[model samples]
Target: MLTAAIVAILVTMVLALIRAFLGPTEYDRMLAANAFGTKTVLLIALAGHALSWHSFLDVALLYAMVNFIGTIAVMRFFEYGNTRDNEGSGSTP
Candidate 1:
């Protein structure tokens, strides 16, 4: 059961990667990338369960944090043109 869930997540991750590569608009690609990151978290957790590796959960947690931060950073760049120096810009600061 867990293996099936892992496989499904991997399949979705592959599709998301295709979308990221083929998306016409920047936002479309960003959305796909975000979805890919989310799927990666799920895959890691499933692998942890299947392999009985407790450390995988820790890695997954870290990956989730990084994914969230990365998505926010990307969106901030799209909206403000820079991740740094968004101070007082009112768009992302």
Candidate 2:
């Protein structure tokens, strides 16, 4: 039963990864990537239980935090249109 669940999550993660790569828009890609991350967390947790490895849970938690922060940072970057300026610029406003 646990094996089946893990397999299903893995399949969905693959689908999400495809969507992230082939999505029509930036938002769609980001959303798909987010879904992929979520599925990954689920997969890690399930596999950890199935294999009796407790450390996987901690790794999953860390991955979740990174995923959330990365999504937010990407969104902000798109919205702000590159807030970081190049150092080669000769003048500052």
lDDT of 1 by residue, 37-91 (tens): 9999988888888889969989999999999999999998888775456566689
Once fitted onto the true fold, the runs of candidate 1 whose alpha carbons sit more than 4 angstroms away are 82-93
Global lDDT scores for all candidate models: 0.90, 0.90
Instruction: Report how far off residue 67 is in candidate 1 (Å).
Output: 0.4
Task: Please provide the root mean square deviation of candidate 2 (C-alpha atoms, Å).
Answer: 2.9
Q: Against the true structure, what is each candidate's TM-score?
A: 0.83, 0.85
> How do the residues 1-93 of candidate 2 rate in per-residue lDDT, one tens digit apiece?
988898899889999999999999999999999999999899889888888996999999999999999999999987876645755687776
Assess candidate 1 and give its lDDT.
Answer: 0.90
In model 2, the worst 10-residue window by lDDT is 81-90
Please state the error at residue 28 of candidate 1 in Å.
0.8
